[model samples]
Target: MREAGKTLDAALGEQAGLQPTATILKVIQLTQQHRGLSALVLGGVEGVKDKREAKQKEVDEAYEKFDALVKDFNNKAIDDAWATPKREWQDLRNRISSGAITVPESYTAHTALIPKLLVVNDLTSDLFGLSLDPDVDTYQLIQSMYYQLPYLTEETGKMRAKGAGLLAKHEATLEDRQVLAAIIGRVNDRLTQTHTALNKAFVANPALRDKLEAQWQSAYDLTNKVMQLANTHIVRPETLEFPGTEYVAQTTAAIDAQFAVNQAASRQLEIMLNDKVSDLRKTRWIMIGAMAGLIALAGLLARLIARSVSMPLQQAVHISERIAQGDLTAQIDTGGSSETAQLMRALKAMNDSLVSIVSSVRGSINAIGEASNDISTGNADLSSRTEAQASNLEETAASMEQITATVRNSAEHAREADQLVGSATSVAARGGQVVAQVVDTMGAINDSSRRIVDIISVIDGIAFQTNILALNAAVEAARAGEQGRGFAVVASEVRSLAQRSASAAKEIKELITDSVQKVEAGNALASEAGKAMHDVVASVERITGIMAGIMMAAQEQSTGIEQVNQAISQIDEMTQQNAALVEQAAAASESLQQQAATLQDAVAVFTLHERDAGYSYQSPAQLTPRKLSLVSINGIA
Candidate 1:
């Protein structure tokens, strides 16, 4: 059906091409007329300028129609093929209108452009699929319209221009006669080809003959008259006497006649193509209707077949749904031995198995709930005991910590005391050394005091001698009268000074003796004190050694107590972890009990028998075991 639609579309597309082809043919005819009339006017013939202008207008109008049709086609090949001839036509028309083209040049230009126009016509036919028409009738008609009639019209146009040029000039050269003769021969040949093509079209579709035969004969007669007139008056004689206007009129009539045949053939081609498209469309619709009927029939049969299979399957599905919803008591009708019936029997067996499994699972759920509850209770008690043990261990650890701190402090104090005793011993030893030096210095000072006493006695003896000498000097001075009396006063003062010096020497000797005695006493005391300081240094050294031993013992004791405290703390941590584990176990057991209760409730939805002796319930150990996660201990993930 789809292929038929495409065929219909192609037929319609071909039908759409007909109008453009007709417009191109019309443009060909008008341009050919304008060509002949322009040749006549350019040959200096009278009364053809307006005719040429009017024919130009008609050509222009035909070009406009052709352009409009080409636009509809949107074929680049058609547009490109037409461009040269259209430009040439405009140039030729302008040259003729402006009197810039001689008759020969005008005629040559028109002659050159006509074949290009014919080429465009052929291209337009091919574009529209007219040249490739598959049907015998349309193909024959297209040959005539696209080739034969256009060729005949062009030949007639050439004859018209050549004969009209000769008649307009009122003279015929040998070259002009030969050209007219050649054109006449071509016209006859084209006329023959056109006849043969029309005859074949008539044979292919006799109705075309009945419709277009009269116009075909009229065009044939007119073309024959034009060809005869050209041969008799223009080609055979050196002098031309026929009126150029009448020749042009007669030749144009003949060309128009051929165009009328061309137009008739085109109309018939359009009718045939339209009719073909209409037939294809009808056939497409008929095929569509037939396919639709077949589809409907197939659908009906499918529906009936689906009911046969789906009805039983739907019943099985309904039973399965009831079983899925835990309604195991749904009735099963396993009547037939078909696949559907087997499915029904299978569902029935599944339902019966579920009834038994549900009963077993219910019993299992009850046992699990009771066991979990007892386990939960036991875990709770174990958790409480573990918590209490952990607390006691923590308190013991705290006390041990305090004892360890005290021992550490005692050790520290003993170390400080030992250091103080060591320092005191050093100071005492230094004091003993200083005391021994002081005793030696006291002995040396006593010797120096004895020397001072001896020196004082010698000074006393010297003062006595000085006093005796002074007394002798005083007697002598008395014997010498007044001079001696002055000397006597000096002797008395010297004697008094000598006595005071002796007394002073005696007092200094006594004081030095007293100092020596005191120095001796101080030396004895220093010797005793030095011995006492030496004894004190020895005692302090012994006390320092004792304190060092005490400090070492205290440090060892403190380290032992700290180790014990660490052990207690570790034990406390272990107890704490044990308590947490017990609590987690209790919680897990409680959750297990709740889940067991939930499972029991969930299974309660199924209706089951009181007992099933055929199937035995499996124990948890005998059944598949689920994977369990181990609780983390001591932060090990």
Candidate 2:
């Protein structure tokens, strides 16, 4: 750290000394004042890392910077020193900065002993380690003359004082006659020119013309006294670095060489960069093609696997969906796979089973319908037979009632005649007692006979009148329109009934006539009997006491005959009813047989399988109907 501090202090001192400032001595004199400054500057020129770092950090830094990043370590150190110019770099920098002058950076080969442009600077230099031309100090005396002169101020004082300083510094002797005279001559000529310029300037200005001559005369007298003193000290100019034409020639040549080298390097770098860009483009294209080919191969294999497995499975699923929707005709195109074949076989079997079941159900329903129809037919036939039998029985019973009434009436009449015969014989006993009583009884006999004839004639006439009315109604019915044809037929049957009644009436009239005759005869006999009955009454009173037994016996016999007639009539009526029932039943049985044949034809339309579908249609017992355990005609069983 301490060595670094000392180095920093020494570098600062060299930088300050090299910077342009107003001073009497040359740059070499300032460097000689600090021996350490020379060594420190040399070390910085070697690119000491810490010193470079320290310089960058200095505030308000006045140094010009180069592109240190582009240069090597040694080049950077040397270039940085020249970046902001000392006296060595100043003219070149000024040419670049200003438009006052130009120096050629590069030169063409020319026919000259000297170079193209001469750059004269203070540096003691060489041209490629070769020295040339005259002794450098001889021309050095000429270049120093202008620089050594002091600025002329205070009229003549500046030239005299500046000459005395130059003589003292070069140690000019009092006996150096030619050097002294030249110095004296320059001073005298400059003083004369100064006074002339002042006179012309003042005389043209009318305000200062009077003061101008006095001032010049006083300044000239003082300047002569200064020259006598300078004569005492005048010698020669100092020995210093003043390399003239040779120095400029060397620098110009060096600049030309550097320019050529840089241009060649720039051309080479661009060639390398273009080659790298072309190589990158080719390599990138090759890699892209390889990657694309690999991807295409992978995709092809994936598609092959999917088609073999997933596509077939998808077709199978579609087939199943159609079947579930009740489209049994749907078929899968599995391209001849065993699983597809099995599925098709199963579906076909299910369809066949469903068809068989439906056919069997239809067959069973037909059989049940036939059995119900047959039962209904049988029931209708039985009801019809029962109705016919009931009607016939009613007709036969009516005929039997009429015959029994007639037989009963006859038996009563026979009992009444036998009683009269017994009374007439008893009347003889009363004939001797009175002739008048015999005549009264004969008159009563005539009256009773006449009443009997009258009742029988009225009954016969009523029967005749009823028959005529029935015949008249039949004729009226027959005259009605065609719609009354059924009534006409019924009326015709009534007319037949009436005709039979008329015949019965005729027979009844004849019977009545006979009965009237018998009654008249019975009355006559009774009158005669009444005469004898007077006498007979005496015997009859004895016989009526004894012959009441005969009358009782006759009444019992009549009652027996009436009961026999009733029994015969009932037997005849029962026979007629049984015959009617038999005929009706036979007709109904034939109709039922015809209906059975029709039902059999109707049931034959559909087909049924023989295989038992787990149910029976009907029992064999159902073919024969009986009244036993029959069901009602709803769907109960």
Candidate 3:
């Protein structure tokens, strides 16, 4: 009975059921009774039966209370605390997480939920405060039924309201839905933890198996029903809808089915217990009838019991041993409807699961190994390419540096040429000035020659007049004869003198005309020279402008070359960095390959299914270096 109780506890505990919680209460009560399993066995079978019934009643009453609380929560408290909030919250969450609404829209939805401040306040301060506690017990279930569930519902309602607002404005988003999903998940986790605690309590007790199972079923059903309702409330039909509610319903159904299975197991256990009780009664009667025959019959019964139990147990142990050695193909033959048969079946199932897992892991590891090898190969190729690129960039940068220096030199020479042209222009301008002064001097000389010519003409005119006056005196002297002869001779001599004076004046005038002509010619030559000088100055100025342009162009070229060189240098640096990154990537790939190998070795202990029998593993040689085609990158040349 004790072993049966322990087995039941183990099974119920694994399910994280309510039976575990009741089992704890029963254990606490049993300890107070100070009755060991041996005492219960030595005591009358009626006493064991009585204890079982009493415990069953107590457990049934506890379940009845839990069921009543669930009914109240479902009928009344859930509508106010859970339904509205869960509906609203889930709707909003769905919209956000489904990518229908943006973060800002979600915020707007949150703001919209503020109108439900009363609900939020009630959920936080009243329902949550009352429902959730630090300890796990029947009270915990009560709290969950009265407060926690209601709070979750109210919260969901608030979220749903937010979703509705979001849907009105924007579409739902995956992120928003995730956020809401996380909230729901977090709230649901509390229930999961409570369930886990109950399972632990169940595992700690061996007595009160029936009581615990009933209590667990009731509590599990109630909680699952409330969860389903809450989930349904959270579904938004109008906006972004999800199968969250349907999924919860399915989960509840599955759990219900599991509970049914447990009940069946319990029934089987009860039948076995009845059989044992019947045997005990028969044994007691036999002892009462014949004391001598009782001992002999007892020995015979013990032998039969050992043979019936030990043979199957030994076979099960052998199968388990083979399974432990990674032999999943080991066949089990625990040929009875006994607990040993059940255990063997469970072990077989476990072996099947292991086989599936190992096959999956093997495939995954092989894929990983191949991927790591590919990555390593790709990284190596990339590294070599990066190195080549770096070398090319370095060469290009060197070439650009030389070009920059050459351009700089050209600029300097252009500047020097510009300066020289400027100097030549200045010299030409000075020559133009000198020619202008010479032109002015020639003009002054031409003016003086003209004045001299004019004075000579005046003198010539005077001489001519003198000659005419001499002729008139000579005629007066001839008429007066000898007395006038002296006067006539004076007039003739004066006329002769005037003629000489006229000849001299003509010569002087001719000389002055020649001098003036020469001066005018010199002035023309000087003006032409000055013009030539001005042309030279202008030409020199043009040359200077050209030189200046050349200097500017050369300077610009030098600057451009410098910039190109700098850019090339930067490219070289980046290429070097890329090479380093590639190297690091190669190392990482190698590490990943090692890890994949290790994983492959780890799962080698498990036997794979026949379907995976032909699985082939990659060799390390496949990960090694291979001849690769080189690709040339263009440089800045």
Query: Which candidate's lDDT is highest?
Result: 1
TM-score of each: 0.49, 0.16, 0.37
What lDDT does model 3 reach?
Answer: 0.57
Candidate 1, poorest ten consecutive residues by summed lDDT: 613-622
Each prediction's total of clashing residue pairs, residues at least 3 apart in sequence or on different chains, is 1, 22, 39
Instruction: Give the Cα error of residue 187 in candidate 1, in Å.
Output: 1.8
- lDDT for each residue of candidate 2 in 469-563, tens digit (9 for 90 to 100): 66676677667777667777776676677667656666766766676676667656666666664665666566554455555655665576566
Candidate 3 residue lDDT tens string, 1-637: 3444444333333223233322322222222121111122222222343553464355445434434443443435534543453355447545533547553544555444433433433333233232232223323333333323333333333333333323333334556555555545644664465455445434543333444556555645654554444334333333534333343234334334333333443443344444444555565556556766777899999899888779777877887787788777776564568776787778778877777777777777777787787788778777766776677777777887788888888889888888888888888889889889998988988888898899999999999999999999999999999999999999999999999999999999888898889889988999999898989899998898889889998988888887888887887788878778888888998898888888877877766557754355675566455445555535321
Top-TM-score candidate index: 1
Error of 3 at 148 (Å): 51
Q: Report, for every candidate in turn, its global Cα lDDT versus the true structure.
A: 0.81, 0.41, 0.57
Error of model 1, residue 80, in angstroms: 1.9
Off by over 4 Å in 2: 1-249, 252-261, 295-299, 302-306, 316-637
lDDT against true structure, model 1: 0.81
